[model samples]
Target: MSCRIRIRLTSSVVICLALIYIVLFNGLALYSLTKSTYTPASVPVNRGRLYFAYLGFNTWKCKIPHFAKQPLPLTALASFPGSGNTWVRHILQQATGINTGSVYKDYILKVVGFPGEGVDNSSVLVIKTHDWGINERKRYQRAILILRNPKEALLAEFNRKNGGHIGHAKTEHFKQSWKPYVNESARQWFEMAEDWLNFTGDLHILIYERLKADPVNEIKSLLNFLQIRISQKELMCVLENMKGRFKRPSKNLTNYDPYSHEMRSTLLQYEQQINRTIDKRYRYTTRSHT
Candidate 1:
């Protein structure tokens, strides 16, 4: 072959190889990204059984089950402010490997703001909102309502507004006394709880205290309720994440005398009213298995 022809042929071969490499690499990367973003409807049941079997030579075998894929709806992790909504979201992201969206538009908050008007997509949108009233419930297919003790939640809000990390140093609201803020926070807390209690849809109520006490069981319940199946390895990873990285500082306002007698009275009254109302509708379940 002529020298010029040989050189041109070699260059063409190299270009073809480079194109092939790019295409293969990009295809693999896209597949991995999508797999990591969401849990598959079914995984190897034998894998889970092997994992457990190795840990203990127990004869229990994991049963393989098939799940029919269904269209995911817009789910909301709704709660009153300071009710551990963010913490639950963290656990969910770790457990299910899905990116949960938020409705708020705050840039600092790192949230995917609500979709544009009439823009419905084909993905599950998990939003976090403190909005009260049953009118908003019509927009969501399912909701996980996280409730906290009114006294503790109000106190946490009081500290958050006064001096905690979320406090604005120069804002007048941040400079105000804790009593008025606690009263207002308590009022809003009860209102939000009442609204969720009245919601006539697929709703699950999770108590913040119960979550703190038995996170594994509570998280399992949550996963079952959401219809997301995860293996034991994933559950262990989630528990580790909860223990190591997701732990937040406990804000105890009682130690600092953040509430006065009147404030305490107001919180107690609202708590009684809320408990009396919701106790009839929702009972906290400690079911460990689905």
Candidate 2:
């Protein structure tokens, strides 16, 4: 009887150890969910492989899209600063498995998964820029111009310049930089839209508000424009993994009203002009295409 009891005890110990191992292994696997959903654009990463057990009965790893071995058309993703450009790029990267490029080399962005920063070539999917200068505009064979509300875009750009991405500008900036900043930015916003609408290459205008409201459809439309074929699984992964690292918090940082009466009027006029121009341009394009 003592021997029988010893055997039973040994079996129980083995089972308990097995259970403990299962728990720890599963915990580590789940912990990995906190990392970036997709792999970095530039480098091959061991951690880039993401296993989604929760996705379905079957599990799979997300792979980053490879860059074109041969040179492709140089496309530009032009937008005013603070127009959700980075966030859109993140979504594009996640959806297409391709890395998007930018004219500016932001080190922070490079580290946080945008390895294509400063790479402006066919290897990257598209190059991002805020410049509407003639020289900058003339380089791209195609363009995707992202338009955002001036009030929001200006404030977001101000916050980014004064603070950091996801950081809020100081209340004092309202008293000091807000007026001139708004004046210049509002004008730039208007001009940027006008110039891009007249872009001599294939152009697609993506409104920021529409994207926020219906990402799947907007992204699908965008992909169609880029002529990038995306699978349903990949698109699902992108939708599920929405809201990447760069999106700023929705709350306002300060209690002060940054927009003065004159500033508001000027911005409103510019906004109206941009909206009308966009509508007119698209109507003309639609007629031409048909």
Q: Rate the local accuracy (lDDT) of all candidates.
A: 0.58, 0.74
lDDT of 2 by residue, 106-213 (tens): 654655567787789889888989888778888999999998878888988887766556656677867887888887888888888788888989998888887888
Instruction: Give model 2's TM-score versus the native structure.
Output: 0.75
Error of 2 at 234 (Å): 1.6
Best by TM-score: 2
Q: Name the lDDT value of residue 91 in candidate 1.
A: 71
lDDT of 1: 0.58
Q: List the residue pairs that clash in candidate 1.
A: none
- What's the CA RMSD for each of the models? 13.6, 9.2
Error of 2 at 219 (Å): 0.4
Candidate 1 differs from the real structure by a C-alpha RMSD in angstroms, to one decimal, of: 13.6
Clashing pairs in 2: 65-97
